[model samples]
Target chain A: MTIAPDRLSPFQDEFYSALMQAHEGLTEAQSHALNARLVLMMANRIGDLDSLVDILKTARSYEHG
Target chain B: MAYDYTPFPYVSPPGLTAPEARHRVVIVGAGPIGLAMAIDLAQRGVASVVLDDNNVVSVGSRAICWAKRTLEIFDRLGVGERMLAKGVTWKIGRQFHGAEEVYSFDLLPEEGHKYPAFINLQQYYAEEYLVDRARDFPELIDLRFKNKVVAHEDRGNHVALTVETPEGTYSLQTEYLLACDGAGSATRERMGLDFTGQTFQEQFLIADIEMDESPFGPDPVPERWFWFDPPFHAGKSALLHAQPDNIYRIDLQLDVDADGKAEAAPEKVIPRIKAIVGDKPFRLDWVSVYKFRCIKLDRFVHNRVIFVGDSAHVVSPFGARGGNGGIQDIDNLGWKLVAVLAGEADERLIETYHDERSHGSAENILNSSRATNFMTPKTPIEALFRAEVLRLAHDQPFARKLLNSGRLSVPCSLEGFPLQTPGTGAVPSGRAVVDAPINGPEGDGWLLEQVQTGGFTLVGFGDVQLPEVDGIARVGINQRSADYPCFTALKGLAIRRYGEGRAYLFRPDGHVCASFTAPEADAILAARARAMGAELEPSR
Candidate 1:
């Protein structure tokens, strides 16, 4: 339920910038679409069903927190 | 400089003047596959006739990426070392998004193997090498250039072929006919067989350019460079590979509606080259426009005729599977065909060729198809996914793994196939033998070279004394004091790859059929029998 330590440790800012730049020219709908696709893609990269389920719960909990 | 396409001398065949005796095997098309098939058969003390319409090696750098597994197979056919020596060896692959590099992967990080991950030698060179090697067994391999197979008939026990030579058309007969006639297979066409698969509409423009300056920047090293939405060619994918003789292969994705004729023209192609190479002086060696097609025949075997290479199946060139898979088909079929012809194995054994290779081709098709989809996304949603995947890959390790310009070709595991007796070990059953360095009483040599020349091999590792099995060659590793041929596992690589105190049974094609922790003669015999299709079940 926790992010791996130093997941993006050295390139944290670069990753954040790249993530923002991905949606730079897109409209709100387009940005949403890109994010949706990114989520699905990242989920597939994760690959494990159990890990994805836990990550989903953790993500929802963070939203309320 | 471009390759000189020197045509092989065509001689008048005996069939032109009079009918010849029935050959054991007749291989159609003298391309890489046909030449390799002939060489493989000749090596096993079997004679074969190789016929081709063209005398010269294939034009252009059609297939440049020779995978390690395919190289090993070629090594067995006696041309691997030559091809490797002439090829531009490369292992690293870099994927870029626009101007920024997303990631790079090292295909062969670990050493101690005979061949590298890949070598970029043009198909023409490969065909030439195979032709020369085939000539080594002149008496066994009757290579008839400029002789085309116009028609062939399956006459129950044997197949009769009508070959059209420069002199005149003549009749020839063979116990088995091997069709290596490529994608537009005349053999398959004449037989009226069903060739089916998906075709992607997206077209790609491929060109081979000769340049003094390196496109890979200062002090350039030969490596596969792939670009997605490159700055030079916006909104399109491009690929660059280095070949021998200062030649570079550049493939740029084109619009689906783009005319191949117009796109391939120098007028259109020169500018595209300029955009990528940037004002660098370069000469165009070859230019071509091709659409992706993943097609294959329903069955590779039909009566007395067997299909090999592109004649059996076709896939997109992205994965370099087309030529590699074809070479593998020869590797699997060569031994079985020899055994069957020698009356050592049942005729049913040839059917396993279809079983194993069809599965291998299907795997190749599936992989190439998936890579094509990723490179050229079809639907809008698919495009979105691809775009995001590329975007995320810039810094994300997880996303980087998802980046696939093309998943390069590797040996297809034949695990659980009909011929293999199921067993588990470091090498495992039905997997191609992994090469390692070893020092024999004679001299230092490669493991594959020692065991994979021909016939069943029983390889014992560490202190395990090899059991004597009739008709099988026994090799002991790290048994310095043994009587038969033995090797000292250099740096313990052999023992590391194949576990200590274990033994392995390898097929004639250099595939592991069974492994044992305890060396038993009976178990080895049974595994050998299974690998020979003695216990073969009814066709699936």
Candidate 2:
């Protein structure tokens, strides 16, 4: 799915930019290291993604129906 | 690869003596608050020492409920994921009167936070997580366990502390001292600060038990379950909270005639639980009695030493506000301490910690007292009122407001002061922006999210230029989207009324320092300077 620029928000964009920057100019091993950090950071920052997904899905479904 | 070594002689003997080596800041009590301060100072590259009488982080469950704000603080320290993993996330709470279901509320429905409603993790686990994280910065923080502060003298320039450890007594001098030494703070007592408030005549017995019959059923709800009436007793109620693992925290009302005090015996609690849940067998893991009291110190600062956490003020645990309030206290004090130590602000800036936190503590105390009054009714009239309110909430949305008032944890605004810039419109109170996501130019999440970045945040709705305040960041967001997802529907009108063209200056701990219609760089800087006790030219 395509990420909306506005939907990402400036804060979310900054986080995404930081994560992408960490991945740049890295060896395969280094990229993996940064990826692990990003995963944990994302998990902590956006807790229980399933719940958020459910929320967004419900909102979308209600709007459509 | 030899490290430089220098042995300093002991300054004080066994009891109390003047500190020989002066530190930038000295934090008393190695509990969560002290550790949090150490982490905050360490992030700012300031050196500090955290002293505690207990050698190890606590393993017991002193506090179980972790608020959304605090989870964000833990996230900044980079351990929030680990905590979230181990904790139980709850959003819905069921309130019952005897066997009759009165009303229920969904915490998650009121959305703007990126974090969940709340997490139930033992306090000891949080402390251990912090202690583990602190290992990365050994130089920035000196964790001295089993070291007790026996005496302290506030010299005009610095505070002299006398600490006694098992290794022998020693004196350490520090530029400033933070007393987070619990409710019966020795430092506060020694400094002659009076902690005045009303103590409930009734005592509550709290037990963490493993039970076969789930009082809340098997569905799992994050909201606090309250049973208002019982056949055995008229006014007595029981509070059941689902903690991590198979553990459940049960708070039962005790009769004045019970054989022993509530906390003294485990047997005192089991009978009460059995009376409510019938013959449900259970094994008690831990039990204690809490004497509910709503007390605040008249002043939070005594000389160069400032109080934080339970040392400064304490609230009734009915609302689970004590630990959350204490952590927020450190969040308030941490940034100011950083500014002072880094020479960005003056030492007088530390006084705001006293001014702002004291107010926050008083509010929490008032909220907790109100919750306690509702939970355990003292008079028949009060009981009738509480019953009617709960019953009405089942039908009316307005009635839900009274029940939900104390549940939501929102930061208090620092508006209407000379230091803050007053705009033409009214500033949103706690209710209006209660569930709004911590959003601005920086991003959208909870207030703790911004604080985790360990710097000040400038939240402006309209086109406000970024100010030149040191250690502060500015974020400009569309006023339309400022309403948080969870609270959008709940407070849409309120946000529109008061939030237009406003700018809020949030401290690293997430409380607002100064807010304005437009960014007033001079006023904001001056307020920060005053809070940090920094030397800045007066702005006319």
True interface contacts reproduced by each model, as a fraction?
0.00, 0.00
lDDT of 1 by residue, B401-503 (tens): 7777877898999998978888878987989999999997678889989779699999999878877778999998987666568888899999999998889
Predicted model 1 interface RMSD: 11.1
Worst 10 residues of 2 chain B by lDDT: B1-10
Clashes of each: 0, 21
What pairs collide in candidate 1? none
Index of the highest-lDDT prediction: 1
Q: Report the C-alpha lDDT of model 2 over B73-107, residue by residue, as the tens digit.
A: 66776667888998988876776666666567676
For candidate 2, the TM-score is: 0.73
Report iRMS values in order.
Answer: 11.1, 21.9
DockQ of each: 0.07, 0.01
Candidate 2 docking classification: incorrect
lDDT of 1 at B6: 92
Report the poorest 10 consecutive residues by lDDT, candidate 1 chain B.
B377-386
Worst 10 residues of 1 chain A by lDDT: A1-10
